[model samples]
Target chain A: MKYVDEFRDPAKAKALVKEIAALREMITPHHQTPLQLMEFCGGHTHTIFRYGIEQLLPDWIELVHGPGCPVCVLPMGRVDDCVALAERPDVLFTTFGDAMRVPGSKKSLLQAKAEGADVRMVYSPLDALQLAKKHPDRQVIFFALGFETTMPSTALTVLQAEREGIENFSLFCNHITTVPTIKAILDSPDMRIDGFLAPGHVSMVVGEQPFRFVAEHYRRPIVITGFEPLDILQSIWMLLQQMADGRCEVENQYARVVPSRGNSPGLDAIAQVFELREFFEWRGLGSIDHSGVRMRPAYAPFDAEKKFAVPKLRITDPKSCQCGEVLKGSIRPWQCKVFGNACTPESAMGALMVSSEGACAAYYNFGDLQELLQRREKEAIPA
Target chain B: MCLGIPGQVVELIDSEQMMAQVDVAGVKRPVNIACIVDEHHPPEACIGDWVLVHVGFAMSRIDAGEAARTLAILAELGDLQEEQAAMHEGAR
Candidate 1:
């Protein structure tokens, strides 16, 4: 906890809060729209709500959550495809713990398992490969997802599987790139974002170079942030400083973990095994071109998409759910019609309510007493 | 969901496989060091060195000096009287 405990020091947090309070003077009349700052990663959103960090900040600065949670962005059709793969008699579908709870078009992977499917939760893709090794007769398919932070390990697992001659192991790749997705968000006509706190873990793999467009093209300051409380506070302070100084640049607040040049071997592995898909559908964001990655042609033998016949149909989100607005930072999660009443975490009607890193679920699970009370008060008012 | 935590390397389980036992918050578990261990870098994880372990893999080595520097920057704007008291105590 050496790196973590220091970031959570209450005394330091208070000092940072004082510094942030002083930043209110920097927001002049030119900074219209209430200094809307987007924490572009779900991890930052989680940390912000978990430590009651918003309560410490001045009301002038609004921290909006972006669509960075991979699970939250996974469309219903993809979940149905995952279920299709999982239900196959010859296949053993392996996925992460949180993904098991994500509802598909019909049911979740957990429900699929209950219906006698060979679906298992794995911590790593390598664990799924071990399953293939243990049961040579079964086709082990690892459900791979996330940004650059997780792409390297999945690529490496594929390389390892091939090296070990594990023919039965394959990958159900849903890996997406963060840069294109961010660009898509920035290009949207309704975008009113002033600054950004970029995803730290993705920066660790892809480096700071990919985020330069945010500063150079869109003219928004971005500070790559860590998951800890102090890291987030400091990053916000950095973003505010850039805004005050009239400088738009991609700065690194989590430099200790994220190198400016990125991880070389991880990049090499990703390049060797995967290539960008022309377009991919996000749960709420629709289809963004070149925002996703699939196994390269050479690795077709290891691609689950090629091995299995999934339901490749696209399913629309529920009518009452306004996840698109929440994901675009246009509306708060509670402002949606079905927020607490119909889309509570216990019975989520949207992807945003399913994942812990998701904006709605994070707000529901970690909001401080005062915030929760305010939300409940709003819930009392009819939609 | 990249929830990587800092963990101290306790032992190397398989050198060829690049697997190591890491102690994270007093819980020991095996984590792969493949991503961090490059041909140029090699496996630099000693028994006590800390690494950021994410989903059963060590993503990167945590620099102790960098960690201290970040902590120092955060604590710099703290109460002046407490800083003075701490300085005075250190003088003893």
Candidate 2:
């Protein structure tokens, strides 16, 4: 209770809310309406919805979800690639538990595991290393995923495997970086982001350096926020202040966990293990040039692509699913055709509903949000 | 990607395995010391030491000096004033 109790202090929470409301009042007249802010982390998106932050906000301020869920944005082909690798004989595929239910092209990892594939859920890359040690003869493949914050762990796995001469271990690298994906989203024709609530975990590894590209070059205000309710509220206040001042800069709101240099030891472990891929495909965002890391050639023996021979396959996203539009921040989840009736969590049509962090799932699980939304819609229309 | 959470090490009691309990905002979680296992510290990493934990591993020990610096800034900024007072204070 040492760390958590202090950060979650109710008095501090009330103070942060008070601070945020004041910040909102400062920018009240700027837009003639509420400020349209986008929180660009899936974790932050989940927390906001869970805590009913949407209801707490002033009517003029809007928080749109961004494309940051690594599991949700994982391309159909990559999921299929993981499925194929899992199916291979004498192969044990490992991934974070959240990914098991994510619908790939034909089947989810959970389905493949149900069919007797050795798909083990791991909390970290180190867990996969232990699996490799246990199964000396069988090939151990860790489905590496996430933004820069997570890449260091995967990088460590590869580095440790090489250092220990673990021949049977390899990485099916789908490790994506956050900045490039943000740039791609911003560069798109539908760019209307007034401010950004940057991701905390990702910033912990990449530091505050790359994000300056979005702030300075793109002329946008961004505050890197943590996942907690108070953490997010404080960040929103900081971002709004930047907008009111007519200034744009990268600011670290989650300073307790993040520093200017970041976790250098974690950074070194990754740099030693992996390098950039020319391009990698994202689920909703398509392929961004050089946005991810593949295992370096020196670690070729530990590359799952070479070990399992998972064939290249073209997998299209569901045509009716609006996950693409939602992920691109061009449309809201409610705008999707199959949101409540058809694409409920149990019968998820896309990856967005699979993870708790998915905006759609977050919207579904928390309180009577969907019903409230319906009530509002009915009242708004003239009878 | 590795999402490292900042937690305070509660005790190094599990000194032999280089394992200890860390409190993340109040959640008591067990972490391994594979990376930062100190023999002198044993199973006891010490209570109230803030550490960066990744994937159940206590990767690095945080410096108290840095934490003091942060808290000093928060105090200097006067993080707790009435809403308007806080805004005016934060803006400066």
Candidate 3:
């Protein structure tokens, strides 16, 4: 907690908040619309809502939660494919605990486990490899899904498996790139995000270079942010400072863990093992080009998609689910019609309601539900 | 799933494998130091380095100097705010 506690100092957060409040005046004169600052990672969204960062800031600045949660953005069809792989008699499907409750077309991985699929929750891909080592007869397939932050670990695990000649272990690769997704968001017609709080951990792997387009091409100020309350506050202050000065740049506020050039070894491993798929489907956001990664041809033996026959079908989201709008930052989670009612975390209709890092789930868990609902109702009433 | 915790490398479990035992909040776990290890800072040299451990791997080394600098800046901001408040009070 050495790095964490210092970043979470209340006094420091208070000081930063005071600075941000003063910038609101400098910024308000230039822009009449409420400054839309999208925290592009679900981790940031979790921190924002947990600390009531939205309420703490002035009304002129809006923190729009973007679709950065890998688990929440996992397509329903992919979950069905995971179930298909898990249900196979000779296969043992291992996945992260966060992905257990994500609803597929038929059921989630948890429901499949209950119905006696050989599915297990693992802390790491290496753990899945261990299971493969332990059971020679069983095929251990890791349901690998995440942003660049997790890609290195999966890539390394695959490399380690190949070194040990572990033929039975494979990866159901759902690894995604952050840059393309951010591009997709920026390219959207309704994109009103004035600035961004980029993901910190992803920046640790891919570096600050990938984010330059946000600053240069889109002309938006971006700060690579950490998860702590004060890190977030300071990052907001940094973005505000850029806006007040009329500058658009990719700045690093989480330099303690992130290097400007990124981790070369991790990048090497990723390059060695994975290749970008032409396009990949997101749960709410449709297919974006080069957004997801798959094992390269050389690593096909370790690719679950090649080893197994899956449904490979596209299943649409439920009609009542407003996850797409929420993901696009067009509507808040409370504004979704099914939110807190049909889309409760207990029984989530949308993937966003499944993961704690998800905007909807964070809102559901941390936000005062009744207060938000009453406010929504008040806004709904005609004058 | 993107959660990366800062931990200090306590011991080299395997040099060839680039595995190190990292202590996070007093609880130690073996993490792969492949990303952080190099010719300059090899596995053996990473024993005392702080790293951001994500899913059984040390993805990046947390720079102690940068951490200190960030804290110092935040502290300075707090001091500046206090001075401004004192000045405003005097004017009133």
Which candidate comes out best when scored by TM-score?
A: 3
The alpha-carbon deviation from the true structure for residue A178 of candidate 2, after best TM-score superposition, in angstroms, is 0.2
User: Residue by residue across A177-266, what tens digits does model 3's lDDT show?
Assistant: 999999999998877888999999899999999999999999999999987678888999999999999999999999877889999999
Off by over 4 Å in 2: A1-15, A23-29, A367-383, B1-48, B59-92
Question: Cα miss at A260, model 3 (Å)?
Answer: 0.3
Candidate that scores best on DockQ: 3
lDDT of 1: 0.81
Candidate 2 residue lDDT tens string, A1-383: 01222344657766766676777656777654556788888878866865567766667778888878888888778888899989988898988866888877789899999999999877666668778898898888988888876776677667767878899888888888788888887888876677899988777777789899888899889998976677777888888889778889999987766777676767776787788888888776678888888877777898887766877677877778888677766666766677777788887876677676788887777746567468546755887
Q: lDDT, candidate 3, residue A356?
A: 79
Query: Highest lDDT, which number?
Result: 3
Ranking by lDDT: 3, 1, 2
Q: What are the lDDT scores of the predictions, listed in order?
A: 0.81, 0.72, 0.83
Instruction: Put down candidate 2 lDDT per residue, B1-92, tens digits, no spaces.
Output: 23344567886646544557776545565655544544464444456777766666665556665445433323332321222232222122
**What local lDDT score does residue B54 receive in model 1, on the 0 to 100 scale?**
64
On DockQ, who's better, 1 or 2?
Answer: 1
DockQ of each: 0.17, 0.13, 0.28
Off by over 4 Å in 1: A1-7, A367-383, B44-47, B64-92
